[model samples]
Target: MTGHDDWVPFEITPGNTGAEATARGLTAYLQGLDDLAGLLTRKKALVFRDFGVTPEELDVVMDELLPNRLAYVHGNSPRTKVGKNVYTSTEYPQEFTISMHNEMSYAYAWPSRLLFFCQQQPGTGGATPVVDGVRWLAALDPEVREAFKDGVRYTQNLHGGMGLGKSWQDTFETQDRAEVESFLATTGSTWEWKADGGLRVHQDRQATIKHPVTGDEVWFNQADQWHPAGLGDETAKALAQIMPAEDLPQNVTFADGTPIPAEYAVQIRDRGLDSAVDVDWRTGDLMLIDNVAVGHGRRPFTGARRILVAMCD
Candidate 1:
């Protein structure tokens, strides 16, 4: 085990233990577990390297690790669904770093556990950086933390089956409006069908939340990721020029509707990264994250990289 603050995950590798033996050991460890929740509460992340675990092998492992595989409903990022409730990691450009963020923090409910499988390692520099959410919260400026105390309101303008941004059908993974409405209703989110064949949705989420087991307050929202202000000045200005902020695919403001300052947004994004430790990838590497206790992101890379992702409650 590594240091707690800038922690590297506990790892198992073929070098120390044979690949087949590791798989058998891991299976036995999980099967004997009386409290998977309690284990994750203490160690927020775990990495398996050089295990030579292929896609078929992953299925066997996932059956034990993530029994209830979750679908990516109401997910914002662009990804291809590869298997039953499994998807490729974010399809962002390879040269750009995807800033640190908890998976689906803007949504009403998020996966408690995230499993990432590195099928193909990049030629250079494609580390999955992860940060302790509690550390990220404590690293922010006092004023910035205080400013976000009231929480944040998120807005999404998903198109209806077509056009720019995500279509409502794609976002919800269903063509039925009633199903989508019912799902949102359970979350206490408000929505309206726009006359232009679009759906406008609003959700207010908190910046901090307590861990269910540990009861430690951690930075938990995706305000900076969804806010236009978090985009650099040039890009933000261009976006503002093209459309009103509210009409953007997604945007965020204070729960009371006050705009968050661009500086604050940048600070939040930067500090999270600054406090992170990178988990360098190897072919057949697998990483599991406790979503509430840590946030994960990607570093810029060259050449090919393929990572498969699956989430479970």
Candidate 2:
């Protein structure tokens, strides 16, 4: 593994590994790896470039990288399941930028690694920028960092079958109320079922967390993504026009129930994006990210794009 001047992802190619630039060769290379997790932790992210890996052969590569893939349960993103555990990356509008956030950072548990395979590249400006979690934390002002020391409280209003945001069935991937309740019990969250068939849930999570393996403190919460203040004024007003803040799809505040200032959310969102480094997409390119050490986002594009992602704990 070689470094590229402190870039977010360390790239690997046929030239460096002495492996043939083909799907079969990429599988062979992964099969030969001794400590995949350790390598990913150190590098944070790895991109396989110039390798002609195909959609059909993606499972073979997944087998070596993600031995036990996970379903996208308890996730907030809008995506469609494509393969067994593979799903289309967040299906936000192609013209809008999806800010950086560690996948499922708001949940009780999250995938340790994320694997992305680019099936089709956009015509222009569609790079998936990645941010180093440690660097993002350091990029913030001391006061902002200090304010988040007590952690954050996240709230969600998932309707039953209609109305704002995602329905509980879609969010939990199940229609059984018992199943949803059982899962929430394990997450240490407080929840209530509204008379209108909506599910309101709350979770308090640490704003910063230590990497389990390396013990490195990194920004790991999704306060900005969930808070209305973090969203631009126009969008915030649009959402407000639809419903009140508490009734919105999702919301966030400090652990003690105090409101998180709009300025803080804006600072976090801006600093995170500014510190990110893009991993430009190319047809057949693959990227593997250490979820705890990095956060991922999308860049606005003008054309069609198809990127499939799968994750494992």
Candidate 3:
């Protein structure tokens, strides 16, 4: 991976791709691709700026770039599905920054690529900051990395139809218990249905994984995001006082069932954000990221922001 200071998306524009670029936009860019996957694998990320990509034309561009876009099923984040396999980016308060993580890294399966389109840019600061996974891994303290060497266990306590946190129906995108059970079976998760009509799930996953092509080890778990420690102190304390950590909507622990220290979680979260390179948004701009190689998050902004995201295998 390249140095964070020097990292920038490989940009292509109408001016560089010639007259046909104006007519075809991203399709023209796709035509020039000898190997789209290879290019993304090498660069990790690419930006298409000033291509005049409109929402109406986004499907064509998506077809060319991500031929097999996958549905956002079993996704934990709160997002409204906008179209086939596409959704608005996490609708967190514009004042709070979303920390970095590889999409669905906590799951047994994950997307190979993630694409983002900026339909509307925010007034102040809504940049989608991205960090090279390998770089982020290296940026952490050696002790912190060693502590997570074994792996991490993720736990989710989803409610039935209505309760705290995400409902089981929303998490699985299906109301059928049999269907949810079938899906969980495939993921190798241990689950139990509660008397109160809730569900508890547990899955152990590696904290680090090697990139398929590069063979570089990168931090690969969403431990920080899942652990209460990553929440601000006030919120974490308040939640802890209300419910046991194991009963929280989401939580994480060491693979051996040891607790991960709050300071360690904070360090991981802060370092990932500190090491990221922010991609400032512009309306009509699009970004494609090799998900295994890069982790992305949103920065706080003032006015409205509309960024759509889709993922592919």
- Winning model by lDDT: 2
lDDT of each: 0.87, 0.91, 0.89
lDDT of 1: 0.87
Give per-residue CA lDDT, model 2, range 148-263, as digits (tens): 99999999999989887799999999999999999999999999999999999999999999999978788999899998977788999898888888788999999999989989
Q: Candidate 1: minimum summed lDDT over ten consecutive residues — where?
A: 14-23
Clashing pairs for predicted structure model 2, backbone only: none
Give the least accurate 10-residue stretch of model 3, judged by summed lDDT.
17-26
Q: What's model 1's TM-score?
A: 0.94
Stretches > 4 Å off in candidate 1: 1-4, 14-29, 32-35
Off by over 4 Å in 2: 1-5
Tens-digit per-residue lDDT, 34-144, candidate 1: 976676778898887766677777888888878799999999988899999999999988988888899999999999999999888999999999998888998899999
